[model samples]
Target: MPFPFRGFFLAGLLTLLLISSVQAQSVPTVIGARATLEPWSDPIEALGTLRADESITLSATLTEIIAQINFSDGEQVEAGQLLIKLEDNEEQAQLRVAQAIRDERRNALNRASQLLERNLAPRAEVEDTQARLRQAEAEIQALQARLANYRLLAPFSGRVGFRNISTGALVTPGMALVTLDKLDIMKLDFAVPEVFLDVLEPGLILTATSAAFPGYTFQGEIATIGSRVDPISRSMNVRAELQNPEMRLRPGMLMEVVVRRRPRQTIVIPEAALIPEGERHFVLVIHEEEDNRIERRQVQIGQRRPGDVEVLEGINKGELVVSHGVQHSREGDNVQLLGIASDETSVRELLESRRGQGDS
Candidate 1:
C-alpha cells in the first residue's frame, strides 16, 4: 500500500498543522491613546434660578373709579410715568371752594392792615386777620395733597404686565394693577456646598444653560455670596448677574450653572480608555513586556469633561492606553498597537464614528 503514498499523506498533515500554528501566533490589533498633561479648569456645578433685577406689583392706594388707563399690556414705561388716573371730580370742587375762601380772607387781612396803619384799627385786629388768611391757605394745601392720591404713577422704569382692572372698574386699596420688571439684567440665584465658600467671590466668571435654549450659553459673574451657610442644607446661597439684552432668559427659569474658579494642570486621558466595573475603574496599559503586552491597572479619576477624564492616580503622562478593542484584550496578552491617539478630540470623533457605523 506503499511507502511513497504514506510519505505524501504525512507531509500534507504537517503543512496543515504549521498553518494553524502561524494563525494562532498572529497578534491582535488595538487602538491606543496616551495620557496627556493639559491645563484644566475645575468647575463647580450647581442648579440655579433666574430672576429679574427689579420687580414690583403696582397697586392702588385708594378706593376709586379708574377714569383713565394710560399703559397697555406688556408696555415699557419710564420712571414717574402717569399710569392711571382715578375720578377726582369731588376733590376738584373742594379745592376750588377752598381757593375762593382763601381769596376772601386775604382781602379782609389787607383791609385790616391798612386800617391799623391809619391808627383806626387795633394791632390785635390786624394780627387776627392775618391768622385767618394763613388758616385758609393751609386748608387749600391739605385739599391739594389729598387730590394727588387719585393719580397712580409708575415707581420705576420697566416692562409692565397685563392689568386686570379696566378704565371704569373700581379698584380698592392694595389691589394689584400690574407687574413691572426690569429685565435688561437678570439675577441668578444658586446654592453651592460650603466647602467652596473660600473660592466664592464677586466677579467670578460663570456660565449658565437652560433646556429652553439648546446649545446656547449665557455668561455671567458671581454678584454676591450669602453671609451664612444654611445649617440644614450645609450650603451657601450665591447670586450672579447676567446681561439679558435679548430677554431670552425669563424669571424663575431653571439653569445649570458652572463656576470656573481657577485653572489647574493635570493628567487627562480619553474616556474610551476607562473601563468601569462596579465602583472601581480600570484601564489596559500597553507596555514593553515580551512584545507589547497589556496590563490591567486600577485608576483613580476626578472631574470629567467632554471626551476626556481626569486621571488623579494609577496612570502617568505619555503612557499608552488601549482605547479600542478592549473586549478582545486581557492582562498579559500580546497586542499589536495599530495607532497612538494624541488628540482627544480625534479619539472622540473616531469613537463616535465607529458607534455610528455599528448603529447603522
Candidate 2:
C-alpha cells in the first residue's frame, strides 16, 4: 500500500472513533430511579366518635344537705378524691357515741373473760359481754358507712363537669351533682362495612383526624369489634383506643378514621416511570452494570397509591428505571443518567433540588 493512502485510512479510523464517542455522550439525559421496596396497603375509611375511656355522672347517694363543696366546676381530680361533702353532723355524733360504747363493751368483755378464766364468773356472762361488744362494733360500722354516703367522691382520675349544687343545698338520693370523665385515654367508636369483617380484628392500627383540630392526627389500635353486624346498615361497630397525652380530644367530638389493612412491603416505582400502551404498562429499566442501556420491559402492576405504582412482576428491587425521559429512549439504547429519582420527591423537584445544590 502507498504511504499516503495508509495515512488516509488511519485518519478515517480516528474520525469515526471521535464521532462515535460524541454520539454516545449525546444519547439522552433522563432521570432514572431504583425500584424500591415500600410499604403498601389498602386503606379503609370510616367516621368515628370520640368518647372518654371512663365516663360517669356523679350524684348523691343519700338525702342530705351539702355541707362543703370540695371541687369547683371542671376541676381535675384523682381517684377517690372528695368532691363534695354533705351534712354529716348527726352521723358523726352517732359514730362517736358508738365508739365510746364499743370501748366500754370491750372493757366489759375483757373483764368478763378474765373472771371466767379465773372461775369467778360464769361462761354465759362472758358470752353476753362479747355479744354486746360485737353489737357496738356493728353500730360503728353502720355509722361510718352512712357517713361515706353523704360525701361524693370521684371514682377515677378525671375532670369534673359543672357542679349542680352549692354548700348547704338540700340534695336527695340519685340527684345529679356533677359529671366526671377520665380523659387520659380516649375511646373511638366507628362503623366499618361487614365486607371487611374477615380482616377486622383487635390490634390493627388505625389513624383518626378531627375537623375541630385540623392537620392533627391521632393514632390508635382497634380494641374491640362487634360480634353482630347491623342488619340494616351491614356494618359492624369497631372501637379503638387512642392515647390522649395532652387531653386535647374530648368526648362527643367527631373524628375521621383510616384503618390500614393488608400492609406488605413490595417493589414500587414512580408513576411517571411507567409507559402505558392501551391497557398494558411498561417501564424502561436500566441494566445493573457493563452499560447504561435501558430495557423496555412489561410489568404487572397491582394496587396504586398516590405517586407510586406497585410492580407485581417483571421488575426487581434496586433495579434502575427511567423516570423522566421514557418518551425519547428505546430498548437497548445507551442514555445519560441525569439523576436518581425518589418516591419522596417528583422528578422535576429532584432536578430543582440538584440545581439548588449546584448553586449552593
RMSD of each: 7.5, 4.6
lDDT of 2 by residue, 1-360 (tens): 899999999999999999999897769878898899988877899999999999999788878888889888888999989888888888899899999999999999989989998999999999999889999999999889888888778889999988767788988888888999999999999999999999988988888999988999899999999989999999999999999999899999999999988878999998888999999999999885847888989999998877789999999989999988889999988887778866476677878877997799
How far residue 336's Cα lies from its native spot in candidate 2, in Å, is 3.1
Quality of model 2 by C-alpha lDDT: 0.89
Per-residue lDDT value at 359 in model 2: 100
| Candidate 1 to truth, TM | 0.64
Candidate 1 lDDT, 1-360, residue by residue in tens: 599999999999999999988877666768888898998878999999999999988788889999999999888899899988999999999999999999999999899888988999999998888898999999999998889888878888888888777889988999988898988899999999999988888988899999999999999999999999999999999999999998787889999999988768899998988999998999999995557789999999998889899999999998889988788899988897666767444655666666787699
Single out the weakest 10-residue window by summed lDDT for candidate 1: 343-352
Model 2 stretches with alpha carbons more than 4 Å out? 1-27, 288-291, 343-348, 353-360
Which runs in model 1 stand beyond 4 Å of their true positions?
A: 1-40, 106-130, 263-304, 307-360
Error of 1 at 214 (Å): 1.3
